[model samples]
Target: MTWGVVAIAGVLGLATPLLVRPLLRRYGVADDPNERSSHRERTLRGGGVAPLLAIGVGYLLVLALGNTAAVGTVLLLAGAAVAAGLLGLAEDVRGLPVMVRASLQLVIGIGAAAGLCIAFGQQWWAAALGALLIAAYINIANFMDGLNGISGLHGLLSGMVYGALGAFSGSAWLTATGIVVAVAFASFLPWNLTRPGLFLGDVGSYVLGASLASLAVASAMSGISLVTALAPLAIYLADTLVTLARRAARGEPVLRPHRTHAYQRLTDTGLSHVQASLTVSVFSLGAAIVGVLIPLAGLNQWAGAAVIVAIAVVYLLLPRLRGSRLPRKPQTALVDIDRPAAIAPRVDFYPKRWIVLGASGFVGSAVADHLVAAGHDVVRLTAPRLALMPETAANPISVERALNSDDFDALVRAFEGSDVVINAAGRATPDSPADADLYGANALLPAFVARAASSAGVARAIHLSSAAVQGRRSTLDESLDTSPFSPYSHSKALGERLFLSFGSPDGETDHVVIRATSVQGPGRATTESFRHIARSFVASVAAPGNQPTVVSSIDGLVDFVTRVGGSSGPLGPIMLQPWEGHSAYDVLSAAGGSPRILPRWICTMVLVVVRGLGRVIPEVAGAGRRLELMWLGQDQRSEYTLEFPAMPNHVLVGILSNREDAS
Candidate 1:
């Protein structure tokens, strides 16, 4: 019978989103990318409607069965959940004042608590305690709904635990409500986790919080221990309270939308959304299991309380623990460079305010870290939005608007008083099918950034462009025209032209473009891919692989950037780092590959075939480009000089060393 109810609820849960999504789209109920948001793309909100509808229907069916005991309790819980969800839906659609929402929530909480006390014949004071608990959990769930799968997973897991407790304790109302809640939320997971993901908004969180809190209160009033009743929500409660306390201590507005939560911090420290969500869910599950076991095993409730406390403490400490393991200082010497140290001169570092766009990306992160290590006051901006600002900045700017937006006022404000603004953000993937995204990031973003910096009276704007802009060119120099072949390179080329041509009406900012070539280092997917290929059995190079591959060490690039930023006079519009003597063969050898030399003609033949296939297979063209690069590396004129030091061979060798350490 319980399985039947769950099956029906699951069907509704799965189907409701399909019905609701089009309406959401029609109404433009989308969550846009903002400085505080974890998501980069605009996504639909108010997806909580699906699970809310599912739960409501499932509970109605339970009432229709007519033979269930505790009918009043079932009705009360279902009514409370629906009311809370509706209130949240109202808030989501038409924004409500914070006080209005809080007042409404309190009213609902008190009504639900009093009703539950009447249904269970509990004391009046118990209603007060239950109301406070329900109201608190409601907000806690809402606050913790920042990550995908977090709220849904919490609802699913907690519902299952509550249902199990109901079954074990012979409470039919609890059993029916719990199963309905679990199945409904479990069905919402796919919609939340997949691409074009949907957020629950406040509606879903309200339903979940209301349902779970009511159940916990009911379970305790029905003779279950307090520790057991609240176990499922321990992690969420702890996270919200701790975060709020920390903010209050720092004199920050506690109610403001921010991303300082422990789960969010996990992402800042390099964990993907899925990994961080799972980390929290896994610990919550463990704590919930402990909660259930205490009563079943006839252990002291205090013992269970102690165990949950320990779990919550560990979960709270995760961000700090994970951060401590990350590489704080740059590992610049991971590879052994064969070049003379004399070629590279030491740079005298001067501290200045710096803004690194795309600070979450590979090159951007490296540049930001390098700047920070040199004692520069650095501000890191992730793509489409800015994150952390320098502590010294008097008025911190919040550029929460999308980069594609018409207004640049927010960005200009962010760039104010900064010495150098490094535009390191771009779509670097060569074969990505998202043409619009590629163009938006690679071509349009730089122009916008430059305009903003100029408006802000910034001294210098260093835009990082790819060497791939000089496509199919065997010999390259700063003076050569762009010959971009692919969409990626073409976008980069467009960006370069736009950036170099951009001038503020006031002429306050100077623009410099750095064409970085084949940058490789630790923490890069490309470096890892190279390492894997090098270790493969069939790794081979075309004969006479002595062509200078346009490889640049990240360390060397950072060094060059530092020098360019520190230079006093106008250096030039364009700069290219001299080739640090590493050929295709040398790169392979340094990566621990003993490649069998194949005939150059054979490699050419393969490239010809791939290029021919590229007519039907779009991705094959990218492979052809790779083959050509390996066969005939770009030769650049090294005479166009900057005052920066030449990179050492050890910087190149450090790539492999870092790979080994990672393994």
Candidate 2:
């Protein structure tokens, strides 16, 4: 009969979201994207009302059915959970001051704890401890609710574990309340995990924390061990406390909105929201199991505590471990980008099939590998005699073939049936004496590819142009007119212009020119060269060394390409590099170098002398470009209106580490 009530609550949980979401939307209860937010879109929030409503209905059913066994305890827990939800709802509707919210939460916690203590004939001090625990967890759950499915899954898993423990302990109220909490949260999962996702917001997170804390306290007071009661929430508690401690130690404001949490760091290290959230859930599940077994199997409580501690330690260390691990081999299809948000209601632009030109080259191969890993159908068209060995070659979806760059007909035939064509073919070496080869590869190939893609009915073509086309400008952006300083830059500029000029006669294929800045990654000659320069004894930076330079990771470039290529809507003809905030000194320091800081004027005088020498010496003339890059530093607009993922520091560190490993 109690199980029947749980089932009915589950049904209410599932249906309540459908009925409430429209109301939420009508009321404009949406969570907008912010710097600290995990999600991007303005999504409807306060979805926690579903589970809260379900739990309330379940408790009412309990009373209506005359299931008076431990009814007082169940009613007290329900009242507390509902009260927390109502408080959260107020926060969701009209924001509350932190102090006001905290005070109200304390009041609700004290009342719930005192009532529960009286019902169980426990001491007043026990009530005080329970109140503190309840209030602390309410904040903890709220803090951890940044990612989708995290809070919901935590509640669902924890409720199940507690329910199992209740059944074993023969606590009828605990069993019913635990099951109600479990099913209630379980019902919210679909709303969160699916398309047009809703956030739990304060209301949902508060209810979750309140209900779980109430259950844990109730169970502990009823003879369930404290260790078992806390097992399900151990990870969240550890994450919150450790993060707070670290921030406090650094003298940072603990209340500042920042993405430094363990789970957030995991996503920063390249785990998707789903992946990171599930990781936390997995650890929580493990701890919960250990917690349940201590009492059920008559195992020592201390042993269970040790097991949970181990799990928490591992969970905390995972982001660091993830960074040190070998880079993930490319998968089959381009999956979703690692934006720590749920899917927004937007046009899906993932290409069904792609043709990557010059797939043997560094940037080309990296892009090809990423595409293949993402499970997109990829065709690698390599220059004749240049063998293409993509990182994702093991995948059957990737097709490779040698193609002549000058053969227009052949290029068209190769592009047939593909939705997108990524033209990474170009000559980048500045010192090459053979200007003809540079012109042929950098200037002529793009024109040929663009026309061929259009002729073959390809949907989009992404041409990789160098930022060098803009020369050593103080401000670099896609809007800037090309100012080529050398033959190589001239050729790249011509290629970009030519590629943009040849859209399909029927307007079937769109072309996008990505002006990549100082792109560096594992196995690239440029990366190695930069590393060597950084590690040299003469490595020095202008004082303060804080000027932003244009640097894009190969991984970030691949992600940007996939996003731009897959978009079905019209995009501007030119796009700049997806900027990750790394200055010249930051790049050098990241490469394991401690560059000496020199006075800015001293660096300026050195640059003036170098420029003077450049006119007289042909070899030194090329040094002018390098000198400009070092002293003034090329500053591009770092923020993009287009929602491209920037390469996080952990990913850059991982790439550098990979390069080190290879060497």
Per-model TM-score versus the true fold:
0.51, 0.49
Top model by TM-score, which number?
A: 1
CA RMSD of all predictions: 22.9, 20.4
User: For residues 1-663, could you state the per-residue lDDT of candidate 1 as single tens digits?
Assistant: 456778889998998889889988998887898978988999998999988999999998888876267777888788888999999898888889878998888888898899989878899999999999888888989988888898889999999999999988888778888889998899999999998899998899999999999999989888888899999989998999998777544434356677888888888889888888889999899899999998788777888899999999999898888872321211111111121111122145343899999888888898899889988899997656322121211111211233336445677888898988999999888875323466667766776787788878888788999888887777776643777655577667766765665446454567777889888887788888777777777567787878787876888788788778767644657777667778878887788888667898998898789776654444566667876776666787644454555687777877754654321
lDDT of 2 by residue, 432-474 (tens): 3223466567766776778888888887888999888887667
Residue 368 Cα positional deviation in candidate 1, in Å, after optimal superposition: 42
Each prediction's whole-model lDDT (CA): 0.78, 0.78
lDDT of 1: 0.78
Off by over 4 Å in 2: 324-663
